[model samples]
Target: MILRQFLHREPVAASYLFGCGGNASAAVVDPVGDIAPYMEAARATGMRILYVIDTHIHADHISAGRALAEASGADYVLFEDAEADFPFRRVKDGEVLELGNVTATVIHTPGHTPEHLSLLVTDHTRSTEPWFVLTGHTLMVGDLGRTELASSAEDGARALFASAQRLKQLPDHIEVLPGAYSGSVCGRSLSGKPTSTIGFERRFNKAFRIEDEEQFVA
Candidate 1:
C-alpha cells in the first residue's frame, strides 16, 4: 500500500492520496486548491486516480474535488445524504470502496455538517484491521470542528459529541488525519501538528473528555 499526505499552510487544510501500489490504483480525500498536485502524486506512483472524495461541504476554502475527478476521469464520491447541485457517487454509511489491497470504509459523522463523513482505511495485506481514519473536520488534532457553520452551535455540538462516540469505538492505534488544523476557523484550539492518534486525542483532547451530552452541547 502507498499513502501520502499533502499538508497546506494558508488554510491549514490537509489532503490524502493512497492506494495499493501493486494494483496501481489510488484515491484522494478532501482535495483543496488545484488538481495538479494530486495528478502529480498519482503519476509519480504510476497509479490511476480512481476516486476523489470530500468529507463534507466545506465552509472555508473552495474544494477542488470535483475538478480533480473530472481532470482524472475518476469517480467523485460523497456521503449519500449530501445535498449537492452536481452529480456524484454517493456512498452510504459503512459502504466500503475496495481498492485492491486497500479499502476505505465510509463512516457518517455528522456535526460540522449534516452529511459529513469520516473514512476508516484498512490495509488488507497487513491486517484486515483499520489502519487510520480520515476525520475531515469532525475530529482535529487538539479540538473538534465547529458546528455553527450550517446549524446552531448547540445542535452542531450535540451532533459532534455523538460523532465522537462513534470514533471512540475504533481501536486506539488508528491514526487520525483531519482536514483543518491550526490557523483555520473551522476548529478552535486546533494543533499545528499534521496528525494524531486516537489514543492521544482521547486521553488529552478536552473535547473528547466531555461525555455528557448536554455539557458537550454547551
Candidate 2:
C-alpha cells in the first residue's frame, strides 16, 4: 500500500491519502477546498479516487469534498449523525471502506462534534496492526482538538474530556496521523511534528498524563 500526506501551507492543515500498490485505487481523508491537488495525486499514481471522506462539517474552511466527489465520481462520505444540505452517503460507525487492497475502518469518536469520526486504516497485504489512525479533530500530536468548534464551549469541553480518555486507552503501538497542525484554530495545541505514535503521546502528552477517569475527563 501507499500513503501520502499533504500539508496546506497557508492554513497549516494536513490532509492524507492512502491506497494500495500500483496506485490503481486510492482514498482521500479531509481534503481541502482545492480539489486539484487531490486529483493530481490520484492521476500521478494511476489510481481511481474511490472515496472522499470528511470527519465533520468544517468550520475553519469550506469543504471541497462534495466538489471533488462530483469531479472524480468518487463517493462523498461523512458521519451518519451529521446533517448536511449536500448529497452524500452517511458513513456509520464500524463501517468498513474498501479501496483495492487497502481498508479503512470508521470509528465514531465524537466530542469535537456530535458526529465526529476517525479512520482506522489497515493494509491487509502489509500488516494486521492499523497502518495509521486518521484522527480528524479528535486527536492531535501534543494536545487534543478543542471541543468547542460546533457547540457550547463548556459542553464541548466535557465531551472532549471523555473523548481524550478513549483515545488514551488505545494500544500504545498505534500510529496517529491527526488533521490540523500548529497553526490551525481547530485544536487547542499541536506538536511541531505532523505525526506521532500512540505510545509517544500516551507518555509525553499532557492530556494523556491523567490517571483517574474524573480527573482525566475534567
Q: Could you say which candidate leads in lDDT?
A: 1
Over the full model, what C-alpha lDDT does candidate 2 score relative to the true structure? 0.82
Question: Which run of 10 residues does model 1 get worst, by summed lDDT?
Answer: 3-12
Candidate 1 has which clashing residue pairs, if any?
Answer: none
Report the Cα lDDT for candidate 1: 0.92
Steric clashes per prediction: 0, 0
lDDT of each residue in 41-75, candidate 1, tens digit only: 99999899999999998988888999999999999
Cα-based lDDT at residue 179, candidate 2:
87
Model 1 TM-score?
0.98
